[model samples]
Target chain A: MKFKIASGILSDGLKKVEKVVNWKHNIPILQGVYMECTPDEITLIGSDSDESLRYHIPVDGENVDVVTPGKILLPKQAVELIKKLKGEIVLEREEHILVIKYGKKSQFSFVTSNVEEYPKLPEINFDGPSLILKGTEFSNVIRKTAFAAAENDIRPILMGLNIIANSNELIAVATNSHRLGRVILKKGTDKEKQVVIPAKVLEKHLKIFDLEKDVNVYFGSKNQVVFKNGSLVLYVRMLEGNYPSTERLIPTEFLTEITLNRLELLETLDRIGGLSDDGKTGVVKLQIRSGVAELSTNHSQIGKGIEILELQEISGDNEFSVSFASKYMMDALKSIDDDYICFKYTGNLRPFLVTPSSGSPEIEETQLILPVRERDV
Target chain B: MKFKIASGILSDGLKKVEKVVNWKHNIPILQGVYMECTPDEITLIGSDSDESLRYHIPVDGENVDVVTPGKILLPKQAVELIKKLKGEIVLEREEHILVIKYGKKSQFSFVTSNVEEYPKLPEINFDGPSLILKGTEFSNVIRKTAFAAAENDIRPILMGLNIIANSNELIAVATNSHRLGRVILKKGTDKEKQVVIPAKVLEKHLKIFDLEKDVNVYFGSKNQVVFKNGSLVLYVRMLEGNYPSTERLIPTEFLTEITLNRLELLETLDRIGGLSDDGKTGVVKLQIRSGVAELSTNHSQIGKGIEILELQEISGDNEFSVSFASKYMMDALKSIDDDYICFKYTGNLRPFLVTPSSGSPEIEETQLILPVRERDV
Candidate 1:
């Protein structure tokens, strides 16, 4: 494309899209960023087969000039080098070569492959139904629930987070068998539908959102989902499968529930976890007696660690012992925002839930961790 | 060891000695730091078979108390964790266990190995004489000359920098066959012999300099050298064989000698070198004419890049074209400290030299580079 653009502005746009650029050999063109210069704006697109990002910088109201509306695939390295340059850059396309000139230095034209050689991404029809939510709120829902998705592909369905939007409620749930994270949002209408989005793809797509304005989401059938706001468009393919039934995983009763300062409990668990025999099977034991909870981990080789944390109230089970994977407990505890955290458990083997102490009964933002199987000591 | 010291002080001392700490799986005790506690000072020693570091921290004036004088081996991980902690940490040794307590929250005890199990470094008797130089000045000399030493151990002798010290001058020379960097310290006075010090050991040892005081160097036969200052003793084993003759490599007569601003020429070479093909021989071409110098690099695939630098004056034989590895040029250029850089050459294939454009020829530090074999364009 023939154009003269501000280096800083173009660099900012290219960097945002570069995060999505795939360097895999499956599709060589995908390794390069797509630069399309129109009379009004210059769009930069980078993507792999699963997710794609499109960032545009408007030249109509800025100090930019588009001599010709054209398209080209810029090599990843060249694009990065040009972005790091200063001042204004003049881009001129002469037949198969693209020459860039800035200041008294001019880098000779580089050979460019024919635009027809690049794979054409389907023009997503934005005519599909769309929903708008605050960028920050949408990002929070994705991050909080997405982490619970299964990293192993043994069961492909477990790798996707279930997103269900009903008439008056929108719920998101993710589980990796041992742990699950859920977040809920209130909706205005009563209509409903369910979809499973690959957590890996969704996480990569959300990186382009600056969390400024409202982000719009649209999807149709098993085709793809589109998120756009301002001059950026992120498209992700929807996973084709039904999510596992997590409704039964939630506990409806609790024998022991107590509220303790979030930081204190997290720090105590962290210290006790140091003595875990094997890092992965980090089973931290929690013994609650009176108003103090002694969190500890005992290892024959590295000695044991015991940390006492004061609790406000731990009634039902006066003195109970339960063990959990250290990582699961730490992740759940970190997500609690309230000054005090409440841990509810039905039994030692059953799933235990952690939520903000100030959380309302109707609130859906709660972290759940399934206790590990333990032999009595 | 029985003592109570501020966690920050202990951590800082440990970090300084961490570079030489054993990370291999050979001697189990090598993975642990030796802790010796005295009423006045706490000495921490860490070592690999090849390198050893002993750091002492005075506790008499600090928030420290010594209840007993003892020596014990504490695992590196335990020491690192204690360092991460705050407040005064008490160290108590009972049998083979080391109990570390800080506040009421931290009570960790690690199994310690017997201090006697660790390998003891041989004491080098210092009956010979020694020379001292300011720490900063010595460090600068090492930095300027060390990079030219051979990185690979193919020629063990070349891996060390040959140091020749006479009554009036201390000459440091390092070469990797491709290029040689010679720095002359005419300011120093010594009635001494020549000694070759391993570049790698010297590099690590130089960091221990106090920056305020002068460092002493003592050399002896049997391929051994010792550096001592106050309580710190650093010993390095010298190379077995003779070093290459660098004096014969430098050309005595030059057909051309041109002077230019050091920084300006270096920057121009850097920019032009970007276009030079890597791996096959990174050769950047420099063509100097009357009052003008052209820097260029021709890459078979990436086209050519050329930049013209205006020269104040150029006095040499009619015409000459030569090319050297860009990396060697950059390394030599970086070490020169001069407003004007003087380039001297006898012929295209012969070794050319670069020196500061100034006074006494004997005091000048020279950088020599062997020209790359010329190929047909």
Candidate 2:
């Protein structure tokens, strides 16, 4: 293979797919980026057995001037070499060696591996109407809820976000049994289907979408889902299991409901959170009384922190106290994007929910956290 | 201690001394900051077995309002709490607990350890003259030569920079047998004395010095050194050893001399350095020819990198090749603060010196690196 490409354009595309390249033991070739150059465009592909990304960079303007159409599988070392160099790059294949010359003084001749040995990304089939939405909208829905997903493999099914799409609404839900996060996209449409989108895929999804353009989404064989925008395509494998019923976990009836300026309460909790960091049962206590909310954390080794924070409104909750894992609740509170936030809860041990009152690109997002069992101090 | 002080001013003083606080298991009190509040000033002191720091914050401005003078030992957690807070801070002792109140809503009641249990920082006596100089100059001299000091505890003596003061000259020299760094402070004066400053202390010294004002430096009892300004003082325990004579190591006779743009050569070497990083000898081969210098790195897995970099001049015997640890040479190159640089060497395996041609704030600094044995390839 022989071709000449601009460094900036090529490096940008490589960086996108590089994150998906597998670094697992036993399969050394998967650590390389698969490159295919044509007269019109160049395509870079990377896969890690679970997810695959194929990004195409067209010969737009003067980004690439192809001398010959060729394909080469370049390892991470070559990618690092190319990313650091400036100006134009010329790549030529000679036997098992791929000679890459960049700038004026630097030239690297790297040994090429067998590209044929690497598993091929299956061709996705799509005939029905797919959910097409703006990149920002797709990324926003993922970001609001993905953090609450279970990271461990103990319950493999819980390691994914339950994505439910109906005729006119789409909802993303993630829970680690202890905490739950939910986001609703009010303007999405698809056939009634529920899919558990792997947690790792949604993370990579956020980084790949850059340009503010429309993205197409479709599912394949119940086990695979695909996301694409003209030149870039991503396929994520789905977890096969029924997710736990979380609808009943979020209590509708509440004894108390409080409204607060979101940032003020967040800052107050962060200041008091560190006190409960020792090996004791991690609990950050929140008590509400006389139109104010007070947070406190007590640890045997690390001392105690107490803070009284102002609220916008406190109606039903005259006097109430609850204990929660500060880290889980903090994560839930941070996911909410609004100036004002609402908190609703039942009795002491009941699970509580924090939600944004209003924000731009309005969509409902609910974060629910279970209270820890209180101990006598 | 009871004092209402500006949190910003107080925390700044605490941070300087905090770095010296030892977190060793045996001496638990040494892990705490020794804070003494007076009517006019507050002093923050921290000590490890090897070094101690005392920083004073004055109540001359509106920064402090002392209610009562007292002393307390605050653990790492309390110090962390204080550093993150803003605005005014009120530290008041209530029995064994130190009640720290910040902002309007936050309060932390941290149990304080006995201040008397912590080891005392010895009083430094400077009977004769001391090496007093600008903070920037001291920091610059340390920065330019200290990197070459051996980091490991293998040869305990090589873990410090040998500082010599005779008549009007102060020279700082550090060598690990393989490499050497020397800086000549021409405008320094003290009694004829040669002392080895601990490598770790020099590192902390760089971070502690803030203002460009004068810094008073005095060596104590041939084993301890004290560095101080009006409000801040640092005492470092000196390393006891006779330093090797490195002056004779630098060769006066040169078989080949090459001059090049400092940044350009550094960049060229950096670009080629990583190619020889995979279990290879990891040497960046520098070859000088007629009016040009070419740098190359060859590795079995990551291919070969070759670059012909521009040079200012290549006088003396031009045909010469030498190999050096790319990492070591790169580090030595980065320490130099100059536009143009000159390289002088005797033979293939001989040590070479890299020095600045001309630069401002110029106290002469030299970095010498030994060549690695070349492989027969």
Candidate 3:
């Protein structure tokens, strides 16, 4: 391909697609980014077998000039090189190599891989039911629930974020059996649908919607979903298998409720969490008496750490104790965006709910953590 | 032990000494910090057996109040807890448990280790040869030469930084056999001595001399060196081995000399260095012809990158090409505190010198990198 484009434009385009490129893939062609140049625009595609990213840059006479229309495959190293260059960049194909010129005296050349060997992007038909929402709102929903998804593939369905959309609301839920995070947005589409999107795909492509713009989500072919914003498009493969029914997992009633400063509780948990000797699941006990609550953890080889937190507000049962994995509690607290957080407890071993005291009118966020049995601790 | 101290002061003290504490050590007591509370002051000591750090906080009856004078060994977890607390902290020993009270409603108890089992600091006789210099100056010397020291223990002597002091000058040198860095300060004492301090010790304790105060360096007892600044003292055990003679490694004469902007050269190397496939030792070729230079690197499976840099000044032989490890060149260039850097080459394969164009009058810095042989590539 022979084209002249601004270095900044090419750099930004490469960065958006490079996130999906598996640079360490055994197949060399899989690590290459396919570039197609036309009279009107240029398209760059990057994929890692399951997911793909496509970025389009319009060719304007001022910043971008197209001398000829062709195709070439640029390896990860070449893309990295172009990102570091300045001024305008001119790329041309010569026999089996692609020559790139930048700045006043810099020239780089890469042996292009056969463009035919690059896998074609999965066909996405946008005729299906679609939903258009504020990019920020969708990102916020993902941030609230994606972290609770299972990171391993042992339970493939649990590794995907389940999103159920109806005419009035959209609910996103992610659970790894122990903990669950759910966020509901008071906006949806005309048709009702539910799809489980890989949490990894949602997180890695979150930056694409960083700008204050609107994103269109489309349910494409079976097992395929498309997210489009401006000239950038991302195609993610949906996880197969039925997601567990988690709607009833959240309890609506509680015997005790307490509100405390979010930051204070996080600090207290962080301080005492290290005292527990359990490898990854350090257990800390929370005991509430009168208007004060104490958090403590003890290890046979280490020591004991205790911190007392003054409750801002308390109701229902006044005295109770619960033991939980400190990391889960901390994660639930950090996801809160409010100064004060409220906790509702049912029993000692049941799942507890955490939410912001002053909830967002547009989005409702709820975090649930299953407490460790006293005997287990 | 009973004492009430401001959390900030105690936190800062723990941070300084905690760097040497091997928290993952097999012996539990070895991972503890020894605290001695006397009527006049409090001393906090942390050691990993080879090096020890002692910090003294005087009892001025304001920030510190000692009710009962005693000693205790606080485990790593306890130290971490205290670092995260705010306000004044009152630590009182009650039988086997040490109760720590902070804020209004926070109280923590830790099972303190037996103070009698903690290892004692090595005794040093302060009557040995000593050199007093600015703390900043000593820290600067360590930064310049420490990175060149061998990180592996295969050659114990190469893992230490050699310091030779005399009435006229103090010289510091470190080398991993392939590259050497030598810095000389035009300040010293009457007694002349040479010692090899472990690079790990010097690097770990560099933060203690960050202030602009005067630092007293004492070559204490055999195989021991002490660095004291104000109330903070660091005891380092010298490596037991004969340091190799590296004075002759630096070339005195050169066939070619080139001066270029330091930042420009660094950027160029960084851009093209990744094109090579030699793992960590990516080699880039630099060719100087007439008054211009070209840097290029090529990998059979990857690509080729070339950058042309206009020379600011050139002397001696021109039209020569030399290849060197990009990482070594970048490290040496970063250590020079100058805008323009000068490169002196003795031959294509011999070790070359790198220095600042406007050399400092008080401190002379020299960096040498051995070029990669063509056959090796």
Candidate 4:
């Protein structure tokens, strides 16, 4: 394969695909980027079994030119070298060696791997139930819900975000049993569908996609999903398992509802959380009476911390107290973008809901946290 | 102890001394900050076995007020909590508990350690020989030479920066045997003195000292060096050993001298360095002939990378090649704040010198790197 391309174009394309390549993979071929050069454009594919990223650079006589059409597997080291080069770069293949030349007097000779050894990317069918959404909208939903997904594989289904489409709403939900996050967008297909995608893939998409563009998501066969935007396409393997029914996990009624400044509550929680017995659990107690709320935490070794926050508005309950993981509350508060937030409580032991006091009319989001049973010392 | 102090004042003071406190120390008392309140001011001291930092917050009726004179040892956890607080904060001691009050209804009760268990800071004789210099000047000297200090304690003396004062010049030198960095300032006392200060302490000082102020440095008799600036004082134990004579390591004669843009050479070295067999060694070869210099590195498994850099100016030997660790060269180049850097090579096997092409006449600095012998494959 022989091709000439602008340094900037190649660098940008390499960066997008490099995210999928694990250089230390036991299979040497899997540690390379498969490059195919044609008369029209150059395509680069990088994969790590579970996911694959394909990026294309079209041939433009001014910035890109193709002298021959062929394929070669370039190692990660060469990819890194090309990314750091300036000016136009030329790549020419001779047998098993690929020579890359750039600048006035710089050149690199890379030993290429056998292209035939590279695993084939999953075949994705274009004619499937597809949905189109703005990149920003898709990224927003992922950021809101992905953080709640289980980080371990003890329960593989919980590590994925369950996406359900019905009538006119597209809902995304993620829960690690202790807490849950859900976001609903007011746009979807008439045909109902549901699929659980690994939260990691959606999170990675947030970093690679251009927010100004539109992304086309296709629920392809063989448990594979494809996201295409401009000249870049990403294929992710769907988690094959039945996701738990979480609709019943969300509380529908509350005995007490309180509204307060989100930032003030977050700060107070952070201060009290420092006194938790164990830094990991970060449990704190919240007591609401009249219009005042008190947050406190005590540890035998670390002392006690208390903060009093005045509620902006309160209803249904004159007094109540509950203990929960301060980290969960902080995470829920942070996912909200509104200046003011609302907290709904059914009882001390039941899971409570946190939502923005005021948000967009078209979209709805909710966060739920299960209170912890604190043991008296 | 009872006192009211502005949050910002207390936070800033805590941050300065907190650097010296190791929270994971086996001795519980060593993890606490000793606080002493007198009628005039509040003194906070944080210490590790090797060093101590003392910060004073004077009592001004508006910003600071002392209600009673006493002493207490506040735990690191409480110190962290106080740093995050806003508005005015009041502290009152009742029995063994210290109550910290802030905002309208927030308070923390910390169980204080016995103040008598806290180690006392070394007493220094201020009448000993002392030197004064601008904080920026001291910081610059440290920045230029400290990185070359040995990170491991295999050679205890090499882990410190040797400061030698003679005539009107103050010189700082640090080396790990393989590489050396030296900086000289054109201001010193007539009396000659030498001391090796731990590089870690000087590096920490860089973050705490205000660059605009002048720092008074006292060489105390107890093998301790004290740096005092305004209301802050840092006491560091001097390393006890004889520093090696590095004068012989810097060659006055050179077989080749070449000058080039510092940034361009740095980038080229960085790019070629990526091809090193082992990332840690990062060895690269430089071949200089006439007006051209070629930088290259080859690894059996990673292939080869070569870059031709144009020499802005060259003299002496017409042809010579040497191999050295790219990381050392990069560090040396980064430390020199000059647009142009000069390389003076003695021979293929001897150590070479790197210096700024042009710099302040009052300051002189030089970096020496030993060449590595490459084994033929």
Which candidate gets the maximum DockQ versus the true structure? 4
Report clash pairs, candidate 4: none
Candidate 2 residues A223-277, lDDT tens each? 7888887678888888889998787887888887888888877776666775554
Candidate 1's TM-score = 0.87
Interface quality of candidate 2 as DockQ: 0.58
Worst 10 residues of 4 chain B by lDDT: B273-282
CA lDDT, every model vs. true structure = 0.74, 0.80, 0.86, 0.87
lDDT of candidate 3? 0.86
User: Where does the lowest 10-residue lDDT sum fall in candidate 2 chain B?
Assistant: B274-283
Maximum-lDDT candidate: 4
**Model 2 bad stretches (over 4 Å):** A22-24, A125-129, A278-282, A359-362, A375-377, B22-25, B125-129, B278-281, B359-362
Q: Candidates' TM-scores?
A: 0.87, 0.95, 0.95, 0.95
TM-score of chain A of each: 0.92, 0.93, 0.95, 0.95
Q: Per-residue CA lDDT of candidate 3, range A1-377, in tens?
A: 69999988998999989888988788778888889999999999998878889999998977999999998998777887788878888999887688998888788888878888888876766555378878888788888899899989889899999999998999999999999999999997886889999997897789766558777888775678888877788889898889999989899999999999999999889887867554335788999986799887777666666778999999999999999988898988988899999999999999999999899999999999999876322
Ranking by lDDT: 4, 3, 2, 1
Residue pair clashes in candidate 2: none
What is the C-alpha lDDT profile of model 4 across B224-281, one tens digit per residue?
Answer: 8888887888999999989999998899999989998999999998888877654445
Query: Which sections of candidate 3 miss by over 4 Å?
Result: A125-129, A278-280, A375-377, B125-129, B278-280, B375-377
Residue by residue across B288-324, what tens digits does model 1's lDDT show? 7655676666665654556666664467774677888
**Candidate 4 i-RMS (Å)?**
1.5
